[model samples]
Target: MTGGLEWAVTTDGQAVTLRQVAAQAGVSRQTVSNVLNAPERVDPATRLKVRAAIESLGYQPSRTARSLATRQAGLIGYCLARHPGRSLFTDPFLHALTEAIEATGRRLLVFTAPEGAEGLATYADLIAQRAVDAFILSDTVDGDPRHGWLASRGVPFASFGRTWPEQGEQPGRWVDVDGAGACAELVRGLHSAGHDRIAFLGWRDPVPVGAAKDRQRGWRDECRRLGLPEQAAYADSDSMEGAAHAAATLLDAAQPPTAIVAAGDLLAVGVISEVRRRELRPGHDIWVTGFDDSLLATSVEGGLTTVRQPAAEITATLVRLLDAGPGRSGVLLDGRIVSRSSAPLDL
Candidate 1:
């Protein structure tokens, strides 16, 4: 080999190209390209020849060069809509998803979108600019306008939320957590606990149409099935402190519920705090359960019964869907029911 900063000149000192390789290997340039790309498609005899040439000439094709030759970027971009702490979604679960996306040999360009028409405008700009080859829409909504918008532009996009999968042009590219099913489970567990008076504590204002609504729907359906009245409680404030205050008020009702379900793990923590202050045991006096199964669950004095949506599974799923786009492929991982000191047998 020639020294550094110098070309590796052959005996003839002539630059080598695909034609030269093909002649030397007694094959064709197309054969070389096939071996470089869809190696399985090339005949074994041709593949061996191409490999020999590749090694002899020290030929290395960069991804960008391959894209130029094939007119494809071989890159995909995943985005999360801008909503307060855009980074939180990527903190772990989404961060895992990001890794899974990369494990499939694709690049990730994560960003957020603003709320309202401005969000759409931002999406439009990205589409116009062709900022990404594809996208993995995080924080999706029911009947998400972004889904329809992406379809209109003929850009391939997959979502972690299956909002309009049943009615979308690209009905096969969605992945989501089953919020409704998760709620149903909570109901079943509560019913098994001999709790008839079940209350659902959720956000007061409009929440995401996906899990946010599904949770309520599940709560209502379970209550109706169990012949229990639906006692819905909500907090106007968005802060954890606010949720805690709301929990206090709900617990202080004329007839406190035997069980309370919160939409978020934080809300559950808040409720547990109030439950402690009220001189009541969390897993005993009142069986409390929360979702998301965050780190806060175990740290608390009393262990909380929660549904653990592991970030690893969610991230792996996101990666699979990103790699296998334009086709229907998904797996709804089961939520873990972490039993704790609370949720005593209905004795």
Candidate 2:
């Protein structure tokens, strides 16, 4: 293959052309073009003959020409949100997403857009310039203006998170992990390991929307079902210090929990830090678990028990939704718990 596309030379070492392939296949030039661009429009027998001619002559269609004819940029746009201390390369989800997008023979156009009106304007500019055929959104929140803005314009896009109820009837597809179910499963697993006193450390969101709410709900529901104290749950900012303070509070309470389920890996690290400061073993003295199964979760001193979001599956679903066009129903996929020394399931 030449430049990842089939290229064959004639016996005289001249580059093959569509006209030549058409003559060899005994078809008109338009027929050959239809076979290359819109194969479904051609009869099956003609398509086979054209394909044979293409293969025999080593005729490679021009990607640029096809893109121009179809008005498609063959690119998927993704806005990289600026997280203060995080590197985009370190994000496992984005890595998986990039690979998936590339696998479809399309490139990912990574860009930056500051929050609020500026971000919306950036998206509009990309659309106006035809820089990308569609978009894949992440870090979506309740009443996200981008959703309405894009949907109203009939733009093609899919989100990695749910379109919150507050957004109200926006036309787009989304694929999100079932945070509540994952947290509930963690609770159940911890309960089966003989831990009744469980506490949850989740991010404190002013609006209590999206992942934060869903994950906390799982812990609350499961605790209630098992007759465990649901009052141990605490909310704080999504930071190590915030989690450490919350963990300290939970540990100091009268009848403190023996186990803590943190909403993210960073929070789990904070809990572990506190556990170690007290000269207590993690799994032996106080069980700790986290979500995201991130790099931090695996690199922890003794490893961390956490929820593994199905990144591969999530990206695959997003691609499917994008390919199927807009107005498709959103999908919620479940995450599985990854057990480790911090909270060994074997007790």
Choose the strongest candidate by TM-score.
2
**Best candidate (score: lDDT):** 2
lDDT of 1 by residue, 226-294 (tens): 888787777665456766788777788888887888776667777787888888988777777777776
Q: What TM value does model 1 have?
A: 0.75
- Identify the runs in model 2 with alpha carbons over 4 angstroms from their true place: 1-63, 84-90, 167-170, 206-209, 232-237
lDDT of 2 at 79: 90
In lDDT terms, how accurate is model 2?
0.82
Candidate 2, residue 271: lDDT: 86
Reference-based lDDT, each prediction: 0.67, 0.82
Clashes by residue pair, model 2: none
Cα displacement (Å) at residue 327, model 1: 6.8
For residue 217, give model 1's deviation from the true position in Å: 1.1
| Residue 186 miss distance in model 1 (angstroms) | 1.4
Query: Per-residue lDDT for 110 in model 2?
Result: 92
